[model samples]
Target: ACDVFSIRAQTASPPAAATAAPAQTANAPGAPQHFGRSAGNGPAAATGLWDYFWRGLTENYFNFAGRARRKEYWGFCLFWTIALVVVVGAGLFIDDTMGDPDGSELPVVTVGLCGIFLLATALPWIGLNVRRLHDIGLTGWLFLVVFLPTIGWLIILVFALIPTQARENQWGPVPTGVGI
Candidate 1:
């Protein structure tokens, strides 16, 4: 008698996982289920967003050859945005406290802080974009679509909203939490 492994075991490439930025967790066949917004049950579901965000900055900073679930992509974006706001706000406060003589002067402090923050997060965001593209079964090169003048970002937004593939792909297996 032949015992059949999971569909993922048959089709997903193990080597492809090496390119993934975040550590992968395997779901037990009869794992407990938690409802609402998470893909995992219990604590796994509760921390999924934060875990996804931190992993994007640390583990996936240079990872561009794998798949990313929508939750992961959005989690990274949400934190990046909050951090940007905080940095800019601090810069503005510092500039105000310093009391610039001329109101016409350029916002050096604001620009500098925001610039550094953007530079630091740029690569991770790019890698995220590429992996996000792969998640939806698109070529990573389509990331160029994000460079298209005014409409580029809009196009990418649509891409980001798309759900993950329901099965294993060339890049890897279905992300944890999603249903097959």
Candidate 2:
């Protein structure tokens, strides 16, 4: 009878392990006890400008399923802007250094290098934009707004500046700890 009662009780209630708090690591006195490695914690956090840019170019390259934080989008933009300036400056320098005294023709090497750089980065740029749109709770197809001229650029800029959704929508997980 006791065995039968014990078995019945065990089957009726959840196990103690299931109700217990998640295990946490011991930390020094007054130190913060980290639960897990989230986007906001540890050295792997994407908070840094360079980290956002490099991750977008590599880890998230061509990834269109998840949301992107504002920092990630803007960091990539900042990197692209700096790269553009450098590439243009280098091309101009090369042209000036190699061009003939008579400036009648274009600099082939400078044009070629700039063209190659633009071509190489084009897909990643599009992917970043798409993810940026996704961050703001919009579909990636809305990236076509870039083609509508002045207003389109303004719209896309607004979209990029907008904060990411605080929770996951149809898209994948939130990019930061601020959202669910």
Candidate 3:
């Protein structure tokens, strides 16, 4: 009778190993801890021009050459703004010179060229930002967060400049040998 009861109790019990797996894995030595690398090296590239600009507009992220300082971002913005203003102003000047004449091609060509140049030069920064996000252990999609304006931009800027998290968070393995 005792043997029968013991067998019944054993059969009724859940497998101890099944419940232990998750717990063991959580505490397991050498388990993968985090995702990305540290912030030592600077930006990594993604691809394409539109991707770059879109990322910048959203993320407030700007890093180049494996490490970008705040000064670099501001300086680049200033330079690009001045360049754009000059290019557009020149296009308008050409239009005025043409006196609204039909079939004048110079102004059209000038305007188109300026637009191309602006976009071309404005790209590349996007990839930089994506890499910066990686440094911070964030998804590249977070770049979109800055569209919220003052608060959103402020938040992103803070994150971009914050020393990259020591351990990886999510984006990828931490970058090596780059600082701040």
Candidate 4:
């Protein structure tokens, strides 16, 4: 009767192993730990948009030998555009204040400001694009395609939109924030 009771009890409920799997998986040594964050916000998450943008301008300004994931590239692009607009706006205001009473259509002050910004950012911009190409497992030399007549910018834009390669390439290991 005891044996029948035990068998019936075991059969009546779910198996012990079945219930223990989730617990084991939660405590498994090899499983990833999120602490309290959701899966997407884990430690392997990407850096902030501002961090990526500022770092590209300062820390990685001259760095061309490594890879740059998609987020880093786009972050730089977005902030660069914003900064450019701000600079131009400030220049326009200055020009307007300084009395352009001659009714000149040329925005000399704005043009000068834009030129300065362009010169200052040219190297860092190229380096970022180079690293972006490396992340895609392509040669940085391909960035020269931007010099093409009409299709150059379009090609570079296409390259920028391409996703990063999952595996590390000759440039270096997969960039941080990007998971294996």
Pull out the clashing pairs in model 2: none
lDDT of 2 at 90: 93
lDDT of 2 by residue, 1-180 (tens): 469878888889777996797655555467543322232334556477787778767776677666777887888889888888898889888888887667667876678878988887877888888887877789999989889978998998999989988765666556655544
Model 4 alpha-carbon drift over 4 Å, by segment? 1-46
Query: Over the stretch 1-180, how does candidate 1's per-residue lDDT look in tens digits?
Result: 334576657677777757676554546556544322244344543346778778878877888877888988998889888889999999999888887788767778999999999999999999999988888999999989887999999999999999999866777767667777
Instruction: Write down the worst ten-residue block by lDDT for model 3.
Output: 63-72
Candidate scoring better on TM-score of 1 and 3? 1
Cα shift from native, residue 178, model 3 (Å): 11
The per-prediction CA RMSD against the true structure, in angstroms, equals 13.0, 12.5, 15.8, 11.7
Ranked by lDDT, top first? 4, 1, 2, 3
Clashes of each: 0, 0, 15, 0
Score candidate 2 by TM-score against the native: 0.71
Best by lDDT: 4
Model 4: worst 10 consecutive residues (lDDT sum): 33-42
Put down candidate 4 lDDT per residue, 18-110, tens digits, no spaces: 787854555478865432113233355437888888987787878888888899899899999999999999999988888777888788999
Q: Which stretches of candidate 2 lie over 4 Å from their true place?
A: 1-45, 177-180
